[model samples]
Target: MEKHVSVKMINRFDTCSSWFHHLTNKEMSVKRLYRTDACGNRFCPICTWKTAKKNAIKISILMEAVKEIEGKEFLFLTLTAPSVSGEELCDEIDQFNKAVNRLFKRRNVERVVKGYIRKLEVTTDQEKYITEKLYKRKKDYYDWRGLKVGDPNPTYNTYHPHMHIIVAVNKSYFGNRDAISKSEWLEMWRDCMNDNSITQVDAKKVRATETSNSNAVLEIAKYSAKGSDLYHSEAVFDTFYMALKRRQLIVYSGMMKDYAKKFKNGELDRFKKENEDEYTHLLQSVWKGSTYDSKLRELTQEEMEMYNERAKFIEEGDEVE
Candidate 1:
Protein backbone atom coordinates (compact mmCIF):
# COMPACT_ATOMS: atom_id res chain seq x y z
CA MET A 1 0.00 0.00 0.00
CA GLU A 2 1.28 3.44 -0.92
CA LYS A 3 1.25 6.21 1.63
CA HIS A 4 -1.29 8.94 0.79
CA VAL A 5 -0.94 12.68 1.17
CA SER A 6 -3.86 14.35 2.86
CA VAL A 7 -4.85 17.98 2.36
CA LYS A 8 -6.84 19.80 4.98
CA MET A 9 -9.72 22.24 4.49
CA ILE A 10 -10.13 25.35 6.65
CA ASN A 11 -13.46 26.85 7.75
CA ARG A 12 -13.52 30.66 7.45
CA PHE A 13 -16.26 31.13 10.08
CA ASP A 14 -14.47 28.87 12.55
CA THR A 15 -11.32 30.90 12.19
CA CYS A 16 -13.24 34.02 13.13
CA SER A 17 -14.73 32.21 16.13
CA SER A 18 -11.31 31.15 17.36
CA TRP A 19 -10.04 34.69 16.94
CA PHE A 20 -12.98 36.09 18.89
CA HIS A 21 -12.58 33.52 21.65
CA HIS A 22 -8.87 34.25 21.99
CA LEU A 23 -9.54 37.96 22.20
CA THR A 24 -12.27 37.66 24.89
CA ASN A 25 -10.43 35.10 27.08
CA LYS A 26 -6.69 35.59 26.60
CA GLU A 27 -4.64 37.15 29.40
CA MET A 28 -3.58 40.07 27.22
CA SER A 29 -4.05 41.11 23.64
CA VAL A 30 -1.06 42.02 21.48
CA LYS A 31 -0.63 45.76 21.11
CA ARG A 32 1.05 46.06 17.73
CA LEU A 33 0.36 44.74 14.24
CA TYR A 34 3.65 43.41 12.91
CA ARG A 35 2.22 42.45 9.52
CA THR A 36 0.71 44.90 7.06
CA ASP A 37 -0.07 44.95 3.34
CA ALA A 38 1.96 48.12 2.86
CA CYS A 39 4.81 46.16 1.28
CA GLY A 40 2.65 43.87 -0.86
CA ASN A 41 3.61 43.83 -4.52
CA ARG A 42 -0.02 43.30 -5.46
CA PHE A 43 -0.60 46.81 -4.21
CA CYS A 44 0.16 49.72 -6.53
CA PRO A 45 3.92 50.39 -6.52
CA ILE A 46 3.31 53.84 -7.98
CA CYS A 47 1.20 54.72 -4.96
CA THR A 48 4.06 53.59 -2.74
CA TRP A 49 6.64 55.60 -4.65
CA LYS A 50 4.34 58.61 -4.63
CA THR A 51 3.98 58.49 -0.83
CA ALA A 52 7.77 58.56 -0.41
CA LYS A 53 8.12 61.35 -2.97
CA LYS A 54 5.50 63.42 -1.17
CA ASN A 55 7.40 63.11 2.09
CA ALA A 56 10.61 64.36 0.48
CA ILE A 57 8.74 67.29 -1.02
CA LYS A 58 7.28 68.12 2.39
CA ILE A 59 10.73 68.09 4.00
CA SER A 60 12.11 70.32 1.25
CA ILE A 61 9.26 72.72 1.73
CA LEU A 62 9.89 72.83 5.46
CA MET A 63 13.60 73.47 4.92
CA GLU A 64 12.88 76.26 2.40
CA ALA A 65 10.33 77.77 4.76
CA VAL A 66 13.12 78.66 7.20
CA LYS A 67 15.43 79.90 4.42
CA GLU A 68 13.66 83.27 4.15
CA ILE A 69 14.65 84.23 7.71
CA GLU A 70 17.42 86.87 7.47
CA GLY A 71 20.91 86.06 8.74
CA LYS A 72 20.40 82.28 8.96
CA GLU A 73 22.54 79.45 7.55
CA PHE A 74 21.32 75.86 7.45
CA LEU A 75 23.45 73.10 8.99
CA PHE A 76 22.70 69.41 8.48
CA LEU A 77 24.27 67.13 11.09
CA THR A 78 23.68 63.43 11.84
CA LEU A 79 24.34 61.90 15.28
CA THR A 80 24.65 58.12 15.63
CA ALA A 81 25.19 55.65 18.48
CA PRO A 82 25.28 51.88 19.00
CA SER A 83 21.95 50.11 19.04
CA VAL A 84 20.53 49.52 22.52
CA SER A 85 17.19 49.16 24.30
CA GLY A 86 14.39 51.19 22.76
CA GLU A 87 13.93 53.37 25.84
CA GLU A 88 17.66 53.96 26.03
CA LEU A 89 17.77 54.86 22.35
CA CYS A 90 15.08 57.48 22.87
CA ASP A 91 16.93 58.86 25.92
CA GLU A 92 20.18 59.10 23.95
CA ILE A 93 18.51 61.18 21.27
CA ASP A 94 17.07 63.51 23.90
CA GLN A 95 20.48 63.86 25.58
CA PHE A 96 22.20 64.48 22.23
CA ASN A 97 19.85 67.34 21.41
CA LYS A 98 20.35 68.89 24.84
CA ALA A 99 24.15 68.68 24.61
CA VAL A 100 24.24 70.13 21.07
CA ASN A 101 21.92 72.95 22.09
CA ARG A 102 24.06 73.73 25.15
CA LEU A 103 27.22 73.74 23.04
CA PHE A 104 25.66 76.22 20.65
CA LYS A 105 24.72 78.53 23.52
CA ARG A 106 28.16 78.27 25.17
CA ARG A 107 29.95 79.12 21.90
CA ASN A 108 28.04 82.43 21.98
CA VAL A 109 28.83 83.20 18.33
CA GLU A 110 26.21 86.02 18.62
CA ARG A 111 24.08 84.86 15.71
CA VAL A 112 20.56 83.60 16.37
CA VAL A 113 21.12 79.80 16.31
CA LYS A 114 17.81 77.94 16.16
CA GLY A 115 17.26 74.34 15.17
CA TYR A 116 15.29 71.11 15.66
CA ILE A 117 16.40 67.50 16.04
CA ARG A 118 14.67 64.67 14.15
CA LYS A 119 15.33 61.24 15.60
CA LEU A 120 15.35 58.11 13.39
CA GLU A 121 15.13 54.85 15.30
CA VAL A 122 16.94 51.93 13.67
CA THR A 123 15.64 48.55 14.77
CA THR A 124 18.29 46.12 16.07
CA ASP A 125 17.81 43.42 13.44
CA GLN A 126 17.96 45.87 10.52
CA GLU A 127 20.94 47.65 12.04
CA LYS A 128 22.86 44.44 12.60
CA TYR A 129 22.26 43.15 9.07
CA ILE A 130 23.15 46.49 7.44
CA THR A 131 26.26 46.94 9.57
CA GLU A 132 27.51 43.46 8.86
CA LYS A 133 26.82 43.77 5.14
CA LEU A 134 28.64 47.10 4.97
CA TYR A 135 31.58 45.79 7.02
CA LYS A 136 32.07 42.69 4.90
CA ARG A 137 31.72 44.60 1.63
CA LYS A 138 33.57 47.75 2.81
CA LYS A 139 30.92 50.04 1.38
CA ASP A 140 28.98 53.00 2.71
CA TYR A 141 25.23 52.46 2.55
CA TYR A 142 23.67 55.76 1.62
CA ASP A 143 19.96 56.37 1.27
CA TRP A 144 18.24 54.39 -1.51
CA ARG A 145 18.27 57.34 -3.88
CA GLY A 146 21.92 58.12 -3.08
CA LEU A 147 23.28 54.56 -3.21
CA LYS A 148 26.32 53.94 -5.42
CA VAL A 149 28.75 51.12 -6.10
CA GLY A 150 32.41 50.91 -4.87
CA ASP A 151 32.07 53.32 -1.92
CA PRO A 152 34.15 52.64 1.24
CA ASN A 153 32.07 50.84 3.86
CA PRO A 154 30.91 52.53 7.06
CA THR A 155 33.10 51.52 10.04
CA TYR A 156 30.24 51.38 12.52
CA ASN A 157 29.13 47.83 13.40
CA THR A 158 26.08 48.24 15.57
CA TYR A 159 22.78 49.73 14.52
CA HIS A 160 22.54 52.89 16.53
CA PRO A 161 19.38 54.89 16.13
CA HIS A 162 20.44 58.45 15.48
CA MET A 163 19.23 62.01 15.15
CA HIS A 164 19.53 64.59 12.38
CA ILE A 165 19.94 68.13 13.62
CA ILE A 166 18.88 70.77 11.12
CA VAL A 167 20.42 73.86 12.64
CA ALA A 168 19.95 77.37 11.36
CA VAL A 169 23.04 79.32 12.37
CA ASN A 170 22.62 83.07 12.92
CA LYS A 171 24.13 84.93 9.93
CA SER A 172 26.23 87.28 12.09
CA TYR A 173 28.71 84.49 12.91
CA PHE A 174 28.77 81.53 10.47
CA GLY A 175 28.00 83.70 7.38
CA ASN A 176 25.47 82.90 4.63
CA ARG A 177 27.93 80.71 2.69
CA ASP A 178 27.34 77.71 5.04
CA ALA A 179 31.00 78.08 5.96
CA ILE A 180 31.17 75.21 8.48
CA SER A 181 33.67 72.69 7.13
CA LYS A 182 32.79 68.99 7.13
CA SER A 183 35.48 68.27 9.77
CA GLU A 184 34.11 70.93 12.12
CA TRP A 185 30.60 69.59 11.71
CA LEU A 186 31.73 65.98 12.31
CA GLU A 187 33.56 66.96 15.52
CA MET A 188 30.42 68.60 16.86
CA TRP A 189 28.38 65.57 15.83
CA ARG A 190 30.80 63.15 17.52
CA ASP A 191 30.81 65.23 20.69
CA CYS A 192 27.04 65.23 20.80
CA MET A 193 27.00 61.43 20.24
CA ASN A 194 29.36 60.98 23.18
CA ASP A 195 26.94 62.89 25.38
CA ASN A 196 29.57 65.66 25.72
CA SER A 197 31.89 63.34 27.65
CA ILE A 198 35.50 62.83 26.54
CA THR A 199 36.08 59.54 24.79
CA GLN A 200 38.84 57.76 22.82
CA VAL A 201 36.60 57.45 19.77
CA ASP A 202 38.44 59.40 17.09
CA ALA A 203 36.30 61.72 15.01
CA LYS A 204 37.22 60.45 11.54
CA LYS A 205 36.78 62.84 8.63
CA VAL A 206 34.37 60.96 6.38
CA ARG A 207 33.71 62.80 3.16
CA ALA A 208 30.11 62.61 1.94
CA THR A 209 30.40 61.10 -1.52
CA GLU A 210 26.71 61.50 -2.26
CA THR A 211 25.60 64.53 -4.25
CA SER A 212 22.02 65.79 -4.52
CA ASN A 213 20.64 66.13 -8.03
CA SER A 214 17.87 68.67 -8.48
CA ASN A 215 16.50 66.82 -11.53
CA ALA A 216 15.94 63.59 -9.58
CA VAL A 217 14.26 65.56 -6.79
CA LEU A 218 12.01 67.37 -9.25
CA GLU A 219 11.03 64.09 -10.93
CA ILE A 220 10.02 62.69 -7.55
CA ALA A 221 8.00 65.82 -6.84
CA LYS A 222 6.04 65.52 -10.08
CA TYR A 223 5.13 61.86 -9.46
CA SER A 224 4.09 62.60 -5.89
CA ALA A 225 1.41 65.11 -6.96
CA LYS A 226 -0.15 62.51 -9.25
CA GLY A 227 0.21 59.53 -6.91
CA SER A 228 -1.44 61.11 -3.90
CA ASP A 229 -4.65 61.79 -5.77
CA LEU A 230 -4.67 58.31 -7.31
CA TYR A 231 -4.16 56.58 -3.96
CA HIS A 232 -7.28 58.24 -2.53
CA SER A 233 -9.21 57.49 -5.72
CA GLU A 234 -12.23 55.18 -5.68
CA ALA A 235 -10.57 52.69 -8.02
CA VAL A 236 -7.45 52.32 -5.93
CA PHE A 237 -9.47 52.05 -2.74
CA ASP A 238 -11.53 49.17 -4.24
CA THR A 239 -8.35 47.27 -5.11
CA PHE A 240 -7.06 47.75 -1.58
CA TYR A 241 -10.36 46.57 -0.17
CA MET A 242 -10.42 43.48 -2.38
CA ALA A 243 -6.88 42.55 -1.39
CA LEU A 244 -7.66 42.96 2.28
CA LYS A 245 -10.76 40.80 1.93
CA ARG A 246 -8.82 38.04 0.19
CA ARG A 247 -6.12 38.03 2.85
CA GLN A 248 -8.74 37.80 5.58
CA LEU A 249 -10.42 34.88 3.87
CA ILE A 250 -7.18 32.95 3.46
CA VAL A 251 -6.15 33.48 7.08
CA TYR A 252 -9.52 32.35 8.40
CA SER A 253 -9.91 29.29 6.14
CA GLY A 254 -6.38 27.95 6.52
CA MET A 255 -5.11 29.21 9.86
CA MET A 256 -8.32 28.62 11.80
CA LYS A 257 -8.72 25.02 10.58
CA ASP A 258 -5.28 24.07 11.88
CA TYR A 259 -5.96 25.70 15.19
CA ALA A 260 -9.25 23.86 15.64
CA LYS A 261 -7.64 20.49 14.89
CA LYS A 262 -4.98 21.10 17.51
CA PHE A 263 -7.55 22.26 20.03
CA LYS A 264 -9.63 19.08 19.57
CA ASN A 265 -6.56 16.83 19.75
CA GLY A 266 -5.44 18.28 23.13
CA GLU A 267 -2.41 19.82 21.34
CA LEU A 268 -3.78 23.37 21.37
CA ASP A 269 -1.69 24.34 24.41
CA ARG A 270 1.56 23.41 22.70
CA PHE A 271 0.66 25.24 19.49
CA LYS A 272 -0.63 28.22 21.44
CA LYS A 273 2.59 28.46 23.44
CA GLU A 274 4.58 28.63 20.22
CA ASN A 275 2.56 31.32 18.47
CA GLU A 276 0.38 32.98 21.08
CA ASP A 277 2.09 36.33 20.91
CA GLU A 278 2.06 36.55 17.11
CA TYR A 279 -1.52 35.33 16.75
CA THR A 280 -2.80 37.63 19.46
CA HIS A 281 -1.17 40.61 17.82
CA LEU A 282 -2.57 39.73 14.41
CA LEU A 283 -6.08 39.39 15.78
CA GLN A 284 -5.83 42.65 17.68
CA SER A 285 -4.72 44.49 14.58
CA VAL A 286 -7.26 42.93 12.22
CA TRP A 287 -10.42 42.43 14.26
CA LYS A 288 -9.93 44.11 17.61
CA GLY A 289 -13.05 46.27 17.69
CA SER A 290 -14.20 47.57 14.34
CA THR A 291 -14.84 45.62 11.15
CA TYR A 292 -12.72 46.38 8.11
CA ASP A 293 -14.51 48.64 5.63
CA SER A 294 -13.52 50.48 2.49
CA LYS A 295 -12.60 54.09 3.18
CA LEU A 296 -13.69 55.09 -0.31
CA ARG A 297 -17.00 54.26 -1.95
CA GLU A 298 -17.25 51.74 -4.76
CA LEU A 299 -15.68 52.42 -8.15
CA THR A 300 -16.16 50.93 -11.62
CA GLN A 301 -13.73 48.24 -12.75
CA GLU A 302 -12.63 50.47 -15.62
CA GLU A 303 -11.52 53.23 -13.20
CA MET A 304 -9.60 50.69 -11.14
CA GLU A 305 -7.67 49.57 -14.23
CA MET A 306 -6.89 53.15 -15.13
CA TYR A 307 -5.43 53.87 -11.66
CA ASN A 308 -3.21 50.80 -11.96
CA GLU A 309 -2.07 51.95 -15.43
CA ARG A 310 -1.08 55.37 -14.08
CA ALA A 311 0.79 53.64 -11.23
CA LYS A 312 2.73 51.57 -13.79
CA PHE A 313 3.69 54.72 -15.68
CA ILE A 314 5.01 56.37 -12.53
CA GLU A 315 7.11 53.33 -11.59
CA GLU A 316 8.66 53.28 -15.08
CA GLY A 317 9.64 56.99 -14.73
CA ASP A 318 7.30 57.98 -17.54
CA GLU A 319 5.76 61.46 -17.57
CA VAL A 320 2.72 61.33 -15.26
CA GLU A 321 0.61 64.16 -13.90
Candidate 2:
Protein backbone atom coordinates (compact mmCIF):
# COMPACT_ATOMS: atom_id res chain seq x y z
CA MET A 1 0.00 0.00 0.00
CA GLU A 2 1.11 3.59 -0.63
CA LYS A 3 2.59 5.23 2.45
CA HIS A 4 1.37 8.71 3.43
CA VAL A 5 1.83 10.99 6.41
CA SER A 6 -1.19 12.08 8.49
CA VAL A 7 -1.17 15.81 9.12
CA LYS A 8 -4.43 15.76 11.05
CA MET A 9 -3.24 13.11 13.50
CA ILE A 10 0.01 14.97 14.10
CA ASN A 11 -1.87 18.23 14.62
CA ARG A 12 -4.23 16.55 17.05
CA PHE A 13 -1.32 15.35 19.13
CA ASP A 14 0.40 18.71 18.90
CA THR A 15 -2.72 20.61 19.93
CA CYS A 16 -3.27 18.39 22.95
CA SER A 17 0.34 18.66 24.01
CA SER A 18 0.33 22.42 23.56
CA TRP A 19 -2.82 22.73 25.64
CA PHE A 20 -1.24 20.63 28.38
CA HIS A 21 1.88 22.79 28.32
CA HIS A 22 -0.28 25.92 28.50
CA LEU A 23 -2.04 24.58 31.58
CA THR A 24 1.30 23.94 33.31
CA ASN A 25 2.74 27.37 32.41
CA LYS A 26 0.32 30.29 32.11
CA GLU A 27 2.93 32.26 30.14
CA MET A 28 3.17 29.67 27.35
CA SER A 29 1.72 30.87 24.08
CA VAL A 30 0.75 29.09 20.89
CA LYS A 31 2.63 29.67 17.67
CA ARG A 32 1.25 29.74 14.16
CA LEU A 33 0.25 26.25 13.21
CA TYR A 34 0.23 24.77 9.72
CA ARG A 35 -1.22 21.35 9.06
CA THR A 36 -0.03 19.13 6.25
CA ASP A 37 -1.83 15.85 5.77
CA ALA A 38 0.29 12.83 4.98
CA CYS A 39 -0.32 11.63 1.45
CA GLY A 40 -0.52 8.07 2.74
CA ASN A 41 -3.94 6.40 2.99
CA ARG A 42 -3.48 5.19 6.60
CA PHE A 43 -4.76 8.43 8.17
CA CYS A 44 -8.29 8.87 9.48
CA PRO A 45 -11.00 10.08 7.11
CA ILE A 46 -11.11 13.44 8.94
CA CYS A 47 -7.58 14.30 7.83
CA THR A 48 -8.14 13.08 4.31
CA TRP A 49 -11.35 15.05 3.93
CA LYS A 50 -9.77 18.22 5.29
CA THR A 51 -6.85 17.83 2.91
CA ALA A 52 -9.17 17.20 0.00
CA LYS A 53 -11.30 20.20 0.91
CA LYS A 54 -8.25 22.44 1.10
CA ASN A 55 -7.14 21.20 -2.29
CA ALA A 56 -10.51 22.10 -3.78
CA ILE A 57 -10.29 25.62 -2.39
CA LYS A 58 -6.78 26.06 -3.78
CA ILE A 59 -7.88 24.96 -7.25
CA SER A 60 -10.78 27.39 -7.15
CA ILE A 61 -8.37 30.22 -6.38
CA LEU A 62 -6.05 29.32 -9.25
CA MET A 63 -8.94 29.13 -11.70
CA GLU A 64 -10.09 32.58 -10.63
CA ALA A 65 -6.60 33.99 -11.20
CA VAL A 66 -6.39 32.40 -14.65
CA LYS A 67 -9.79 33.73 -15.55
CA GLU A 68 -8.71 37.27 -14.67
CA ILE A 69 -6.02 37.18 -17.35
CA GLU A 70 -8.30 37.25 -20.33
CA GLY A 71 -7.45 35.39 -23.57
CA LYS A 72 -5.53 32.44 -22.19
CA GLU A 73 -5.89 28.94 -23.59
CA PHE A 74 -4.95 26.04 -21.33
CA LEU A 75 -3.28 22.84 -22.48
CA PHE A 76 -2.60 19.68 -20.52
CA LEU A 77 0.69 17.94 -21.29
CA THR A 78 2.48 14.90 -19.95
CA LEU A 79 6.19 14.06 -20.00
CA THR A 80 7.28 10.53 -19.22
CA ALA A 81 10.45 8.44 -19.00
CA PRO A 82 11.58 5.17 -17.48
CA SER A 83 11.13 5.04 -13.72
CA VAL A 84 14.25 5.75 -11.69
CA SER A 85 15.31 6.62 -8.15
CA GLY A 86 14.02 9.78 -6.50
CA GLU A 87 17.28 11.75 -6.84
CA GLU A 88 17.59 10.95 -10.53
CA LEU A 89 13.94 11.85 -11.02
CA CYS A 90 14.55 15.31 -9.55
CA ASP A 91 17.52 15.87 -11.85
CA GLU A 92 15.48 14.79 -14.87
CA ILE A 93 12.75 17.23 -13.89
CA ASP A 94 15.23 20.12 -13.74
CA GLN A 95 16.62 19.18 -17.14
CA PHE A 96 13.12 18.91 -18.55
CA ASN A 97 12.29 22.42 -17.30
CA LYS A 98 15.41 23.85 -18.97
CA ALA A 99 14.59 22.06 -22.23
CA VAL A 100 11.06 23.41 -22.18
CA ASN A 101 12.30 26.94 -21.54
CA ARG A 102 14.75 26.71 -24.42
CA LEU A 103 12.15 25.30 -26.81
CA PHE A 104 9.65 28.01 -25.94
CA LYS A 105 12.29 30.74 -26.39
CA ARG A 106 13.22 29.47 -29.84
CA ARG A 107 9.59 29.20 -30.97
CA ASN A 108 8.92 32.75 -29.72
CA VAL A 109 5.88 31.29 -27.99
CA GLU A 110 7.31 31.45 -24.49
CA ARG A 111 5.05 34.32 -23.57
CA VAL A 112 2.12 32.86 -25.45
CA VAL A 113 2.04 29.57 -23.58
CA LYS A 114 4.02 29.39 -20.35
CA GLY A 115 4.64 25.92 -18.95
CA TYR A 116 4.25 25.29 -15.25
CA ILE A 117 5.74 22.14 -13.78
CA ARG A 118 3.74 21.24 -10.71
CA LYS A 119 4.85 17.78 -9.53
CA LEU A 120 7.92 15.74 -10.36
CA GLU A 121 8.51 12.63 -8.30
CA VAL A 122 9.10 8.91 -8.54
CA THR A 123 5.93 6.82 -8.74
CA THR A 124 5.46 4.56 -5.73
CA ASP A 125 5.36 0.75 -6.02
CA GLN A 126 1.83 0.79 -4.67
CA GLU A 127 0.75 3.03 -7.54
CA LYS A 128 2.22 0.56 -9.99
CA TYR A 129 0.31 -2.28 -8.34
CA ILE A 130 -2.98 -0.38 -8.58
CA THR A 131 -2.34 0.55 -12.20
CA GLU A 132 -1.69 -3.07 -13.03
CA LYS A 133 -4.84 -4.23 -11.31
CA LEU A 134 -6.97 -1.74 -13.22
CA TYR A 135 -5.41 -2.36 -16.65
CA LYS A 136 -4.84 -6.09 -16.63
CA ARG A 137 -7.62 -8.59 -17.09
CA LYS A 138 -8.27 -12.29 -17.70
CA LYS A 139 -9.52 -13.27 -21.10
CA ASP A 140 -12.19 -15.72 -22.29
CA TYR A 141 -12.54 -17.65 -25.56
CA TYR A 142 -15.69 -18.78 -27.33
CA ASP A 143 -16.00 -22.54 -27.71
CA TRP A 144 -18.58 -25.25 -28.34
CA ARG A 145 -19.22 -25.33 -24.58
CA GLY A 146 -20.02 -21.61 -24.69
CA LEU A 147 -17.11 -19.62 -23.24
CA LYS A 148 -13.82 -21.04 -22.01
CA VAL A 149 -11.26 -19.35 -19.83
CA GLY A 150 -8.18 -18.26 -21.70
CA ASP A 151 -4.69 -17.30 -20.64
CA PRO A 152 -4.17 -14.10 -18.66
CA ASN A 153 -3.91 -10.82 -20.54
CA PRO A 154 -0.41 -9.91 -21.59
CA THR A 155 1.15 -7.28 -19.31
CA TYR A 156 3.44 -4.59 -20.63
CA ASN A 157 6.64 -4.42 -18.61
CA THR A 158 7.65 -0.99 -19.89
CA TYR A 159 6.26 1.17 -17.14
CA HIS A 160 7.41 4.76 -17.61
CA PRO A 161 7.45 7.33 -14.84
CA HIS A 162 5.82 10.53 -16.02
CA MET A 163 5.37 14.21 -15.13
CA HIS A 164 2.44 16.40 -16.01
CA ILE A 165 2.63 19.97 -17.29
CA ILE A 166 -0.16 22.52 -17.41
CA VAL A 167 0.45 25.18 -20.04
CA ALA A 168 -1.56 28.37 -20.25
CA VAL A 169 -1.54 29.95 -23.70
CA ASN A 170 -2.20 33.61 -24.26
CA LYS A 171 -5.40 33.79 -26.27
CA SER A 172 -4.09 36.86 -28.05
CA TYR A 173 -1.76 34.57 -30.00
CA PHE A 174 -4.75 32.82 -31.50
CA GLY A 175 -6.43 36.18 -32.11
CA ASN A 176 -10.15 35.91 -32.90
CA ARG A 177 -10.10 32.13 -32.39
CA ASP A 178 -11.92 30.24 -29.68
CA ALA A 179 -9.23 27.63 -29.17
CA ILE A 180 -6.58 25.69 -31.04
CA SER A 181 -7.39 22.44 -32.80
CA LYS A 182 -6.51 19.21 -30.98
CA SER A 183 -4.25 17.87 -33.76
CA GLU A 184 -2.38 21.14 -34.19
CA TRP A 185 -1.85 21.51 -30.48
CA LEU A 186 -0.85 17.86 -30.14
CA GLU A 187 1.85 18.25 -32.79
CA MET A 188 3.26 21.29 -31.02
CA TRP A 189 3.13 19.51 -27.67
CA ARG A 190 4.84 16.41 -29.07
CA ASP A 191 7.64 18.49 -30.55
CA CYS A 192 8.08 20.37 -27.29
CA MET A 193 8.24 17.10 -25.31
CA ASN A 194 10.84 15.66 -27.71
CA ASP A 195 12.89 18.84 -27.58
CA ASN A 196 12.97 18.62 -23.81
CA SER A 197 14.64 15.17 -24.16
CA ILE A 198 11.69 13.76 -22.28
CA THR A 199 9.72 10.70 -23.34
CA GLN A 200 6.51 11.82 -24.99
CA VAL A 201 3.26 9.97 -24.58
CA ASP A 202 0.86 10.20 -27.52
CA ALA A 203 -1.23 13.27 -26.67
CA LYS A 204 -3.77 12.41 -29.37
CA LYS A 205 -4.49 9.01 -27.89
CA VAL A 206 -4.87 10.34 -24.36
CA ARG A 207 -7.06 13.24 -25.38
CA ALA A 208 -9.30 10.93 -27.38
CA THR A 209 -10.02 8.82 -24.30
CA GLU A 210 -10.11 11.62 -21.75
CA THR A 211 -13.51 11.58 -20.00
CA SER A 212 -13.41 15.14 -18.68
CA ASN A 213 -13.86 18.04 -21.08
CA SER A 214 -11.90 20.44 -18.86
CA ASN A 215 -8.71 18.43 -18.47
CA ALA A 216 -6.52 21.43 -17.65
CA VAL A 217 -8.95 22.67 -15.01
CA LEU A 218 -9.20 19.18 -13.58
CA GLU A 219 -5.43 18.83 -13.49
CA ILE A 220 -5.17 22.03 -11.47
CA ALA A 221 -8.07 20.87 -9.31
CA LYS A 222 -6.17 17.69 -8.47
CA TYR A 223 -3.69 19.82 -6.53
CA SER A 224 -6.36 22.17 -5.17
CA ALA A 225 -7.82 22.29 -1.64
CA LYS A 226 -10.61 20.00 -2.66
CA GLY A 227 -9.69 16.75 -4.43
CA SER A 228 -9.38 16.65 -8.21
CA ASP A 229 -12.10 14.01 -8.43
CA LEU A 230 -14.49 16.56 -7.00
CA TYR A 231 -14.64 18.33 -10.39
CA HIS A 232 -14.69 15.09 -12.31
CA SER A 233 -17.91 13.54 -13.57
CA GLU A 234 -21.02 14.10 -11.45
CA ALA A 235 -21.12 10.46 -10.41
CA VAL A 236 -17.51 10.46 -9.25
CA PHE A 237 -17.92 13.76 -7.39
CA ASP A 238 -21.09 12.51 -5.68
CA THR A 239 -19.46 9.31 -4.49
CA PHE A 240 -16.30 11.02 -3.19
CA TYR A 241 -18.23 13.92 -1.63
CA MET A 242 -20.48 11.60 0.37
CA ALA A 243 -17.56 9.60 1.73
CA LEU A 244 -15.63 12.74 2.72
CA LYS A 245 -18.71 14.44 4.20
CA ARG A 246 -19.16 11.64 6.74
CA ARG A 247 -15.60 12.09 7.91
CA GLN A 248 -15.89 15.88 8.15
CA LEU A 249 -19.08 15.58 10.19
CA ILE A 250 -17.29 13.43 12.78
CA VAL A 251 -14.44 15.90 13.06
CA TYR A 252 -16.90 18.79 13.34
CA SER A 253 -18.70 17.05 16.17
CA GLY A 254 -15.49 16.63 18.11
CA MET A 255 -14.50 20.24 17.52
CA MET A 256 -17.91 21.38 18.76
CA LYS A 257 -17.56 19.38 21.98
CA ASP A 258 -14.10 20.80 22.57
CA TYR A 259 -15.31 24.39 22.17
CA ALA A 260 -18.54 23.95 24.13
CA LYS A 261 -16.65 23.83 27.46
CA LYS A 262 -15.13 27.30 26.94
CA PHE A 263 -17.93 29.23 25.24
CA LYS A 264 -21.71 29.45 25.14
CA ASN A 265 -23.28 26.85 22.84
CA GLY A 266 -24.81 29.52 20.55
CA GLU A 267 -21.58 31.50 20.29
CA LEU A 268 -19.48 28.37 19.66
CA ASP A 269 -21.88 27.17 17.01
CA ARG A 270 -21.74 30.55 15.27
CA PHE A 271 -17.96 30.57 15.30
CA LYS A 272 -17.80 27.06 13.91
CA LYS A 273 -20.35 27.88 11.24
CA GLU A 274 -18.36 30.94 10.18
CA ASN A 275 -15.17 28.93 9.78
CA GLU A 276 -16.99 26.18 7.91
CA ASP A 277 -18.61 28.67 5.58
CA GLU A 278 -15.33 30.43 4.88
CA TYR A 279 -13.64 27.13 4.12
CA THR A 280 -16.51 26.10 1.90
CA HIS A 281 -16.31 29.34 -0.07
CA LEU A 282 -12.57 29.02 -0.32
CA LEU A 283 -12.97 25.58 -1.87
CA GLN A 284 -15.38 27.03 -4.40
CA SER A 285 -12.98 29.86 -5.29
CA VAL A 286 -10.66 29.61 -8.28
CA TRP A 287 -7.44 29.44 -6.25
CA LYS A 288 -8.59 26.19 -4.69
CA GLY A 289 -5.32 24.49 -3.75
CA SER A 290 -2.01 26.32 -3.72
CA THR A 291 0.52 27.48 -1.19
CA TYR A 292 2.28 30.80 -1.05
CA ASP A 293 5.58 31.34 0.73
CA SER A 294 5.29 33.28 3.95
CA LYS A 295 7.00 36.65 4.17
CA LEU A 296 10.47 36.55 5.69
CA ARG A 297 10.62 37.87 9.23
CA GLU A 298 13.09 37.94 12.07
CA LEU A 299 12.69 35.22 14.68
CA THR A 300 12.74 35.90 18.40
CA GLN A 301 15.62 34.50 20.51
CA GLU A 302 13.48 31.70 21.92
CA GLU A 303 12.18 30.83 18.44
CA MET A 304 15.75 30.71 17.11
CA GLU A 305 16.79 28.38 19.91
CA MET A 306 13.89 26.07 19.20
CA TYR A 307 14.71 26.08 15.49
CA ASN A 308 18.34 25.25 16.15
CA GLU A 309 17.36 22.39 18.41
CA ARG A 310 15.01 20.97 15.78
CA ALA A 311 17.67 21.32 13.08
CA LYS A 312 20.28 19.59 15.20
CA PHE A 313 17.93 16.73 15.92
CA ILE A 314 17.08 16.37 12.22
CA GLU A 315 20.74 16.46 11.20
CA GLU A 316 21.60 13.73 13.69
CA GLY A 317 18.75 11.55 12.34
CA ASP A 318 17.39 11.15 15.85
CA GLU A 319 13.74 11.01 16.80
CA VAL A 320 12.45 13.24 19.63
CA GLU A 321 11.99 10.11 21.70
Give all candidate RMSDs, comma-separated. 22.1, 18.1
Superposition error at 124 for model 2 (Å): 4.0
lDDT of 2 by residue, 138-254 (tens): 122123224333423222222223445445555453443544455544455456555434334423222313323245434433421233323434543443333233232111112
User: Model 1, residue 99: what's the lDDT?
Assistant: 63
Show model 1 residue runs off by greater than 4 Å.
1-55, 68-73, 85-87, 108-117, 123-132, 136-158, 170-179, 190-321
> CA lDDT of 59 in candidate 1?
31
Q: Could you give candidate 1's per-residue lDDT for residues 120-224 as a string of tens digits?
A: 323233222344454444333355335444443332222244434444445443443535555555566556555443222222111222112233223223321
TM-score of every candidate relative to the true structure: 0.34, 0.38
Worst 10 residues of 1 by lDDT: 1-10
Candidate 2 scores a C-alpha RMSD against the true structure in Å of 18.1
Q: On a 0 to 100 scale, what is the lDDT of residue 124 in model 1?
A: 30
